[model samples]
Target: MRKAMPAALVTALAVHLLAGCAENRTAGAGTDTTGAEIPEKVSAGTVIAVGSPETKVALQLSGQIDELPFKVKWVQMSGGPQCSEAFRAGELDVCSAAEVPSIHARWTGLPTKLVAAEFRKDPHRNPIYELGIAPGADIDTLEDLRGKKIAYSPGQAQGALVLRILARAGLTEKDVELVELPSTGDVYPTALGSRQVDAAPLGGVNIKRFTTKYGKEGGKTIKHGLRDDPAHLWVPTESVNDPQKAAAIREFVKFWARAQVWIDEHPKEWVEGYYVKDQGLSREDGEYLVRINGTSDIPADWDPVVERHQKTVDLLAEKTGNEPFDAETLFDRRYETVAADAVADGRKGS
Candidate 1:
């Protein structure tokens, strides 16, 4: 302060001090000097991460998640296969998938737990999956699939459901010729329409489109009256162990249950917003899908859910010649209480 310094020296010294301060500030804010953000500070209560197959409707519909306590990083995926891959790579903490994919995740020794389950409220007529035969094809019943070129995608829910249908009909993989197809929604109908495959499983809006294009007389859906088709929210073992993440998952389930109730109460909004707007379906198609699929509910107890899952696992094991594992062990019941409470609250509000 007393002695005058060279201008060059003073400038260099000031620059060094400023850089050091910047580094310190960045370091204190959980970022490195290179400006890379730090990992979550779970002990200090930080943001929560979530992944979903359907992002627009599942996460942001009707401002359902507008008041979440923890921050969420949403990842969009096409389906369960991608979600399971992401979960294995440590890129996702939680994912929503159908029962078969969730079972496959556990079968592959991935440390994942089914935290919650959603089933169509009208279980007797749950139109989650349908086996559709091509126009003018001779196939009629599940047993009629024999020796036919059926569109199949392994390790997918459609494939699993197909296997279940086959098993029920006293058929096996060898009983039919399976033409492997991409699991994309449109491929099934395309394959069937073009006569590339004799039969395939169709769901959602695709079912409506196929039936409309090739009427029930042209193409027919074999209804098996499947009742235990539950879609689940699966979380990794690491998240299950972490207190912060587990808490967030519990709250997320509660919110999800509330959203399901909202969807039931506001079917027109859901059909229009999700099917017509997000999925780009005609309004008539959207209405038909909603009417056919109906609404879903989260089961409060695990017994019925476990029983249904066991049936799926048993079928998979029998058809694929894999050993059956305990389906109950694959679930973490800690969230059941939270799910029950959430359902109760949702019903009250509805």
Candidate 2:
């Protein structure tokens, strides 16, 4: 007969496993550089030095096996709302969300720092923000949308973009009935195909697909793009403007910056995975998205990011009457340095 491990022991093992669930890790056994002991506890904000497979084996022989130097935590969110919850709870040290939430987060004193930027949504290539009306429907222009039903992913960069597009066309939420949906993709089918809705705002990927589909079927092409003026939009939500958070953000940015090159080198893998496997975009379409969105190869350096961020803030403020928080203050330079270093080291990505 065998006895189960003690509850305390079970709990201990669980923490270690959860901590290891994080990405960065350690090294292995005899003839190792550092024969450190396995850490026993984990927390938020600290790095997990023992997660590496190599380190796990080496730590087995070390006597110091009862301490966790840093706390490790994982973040899972569908959109900014979920991330906001984590931010409010003081549960997250760093998070990457689209631009819209970054505004609200900073507005509410979330202590987030914009250390780096990733991809920017391109209008020509990544025209995700669109107003789609049902095929063969009577609706023609923004004026036709009066009192008609519309779908949107509220509180996201896409939703905000859609709103801006409508405003540009002399429309507002007051002019149309708004339907809050998970995303442009979630209700895209019903909002555009189902008789329930007359018009729906969808992202560029959906626009490309649905447009291609309609064109193939000889359906009438409703006006497709309206937000094409600004080629691409950036994402740098909850970045810390200070040096420390800046450093962490730089590492975070480095990952994606490196991913850009890795994506180019291994096109079938990195790019496809982020756009298709992750975003559920089709293979060919995802490729098109890559060309359009233009990867953010720059690190956490503030100059370029500040300029773009300023543009976005100004745009948002003009539309919402809430000028964006001064972007310069929201940044943390330390993390920017990390990103700069990565690129400087020939680790620049696409």
Q: Which stretches of candidate 1 lie over 4 Å from their true place?
A: 1-45, 53-59
Worst 10 residues of 2 by lDDT: 25-34
- In model 1, the worst 10-residue window by lDDT is 29-38
Candidate 2's C-alpha runs over 4 A off are 1-45, 48-73, 120-123, 139-148, 208-247, 271-304, 307-324, 347-350
Write model 1 residue lDDT over 29-64, tens digit each, in one string: 241121222233333344555776353385467686
The digit string of per-residue lDDT tens for model 2 on 1-350 reads 12223323432453355343221211111122111222333233644111122112212222212232333243433346665555444345555455666665444334444544554445444454556667766777777777776665544676566566567667876677666555634466554665455666655566676677664433233454553322111122322322233333334444434434444445555445456666566788878765655544444445766676676677655554553668776554544565446556644322
True lDDT of residue 342, candidate 1: 84
Candidate No. with top TM-score? 1
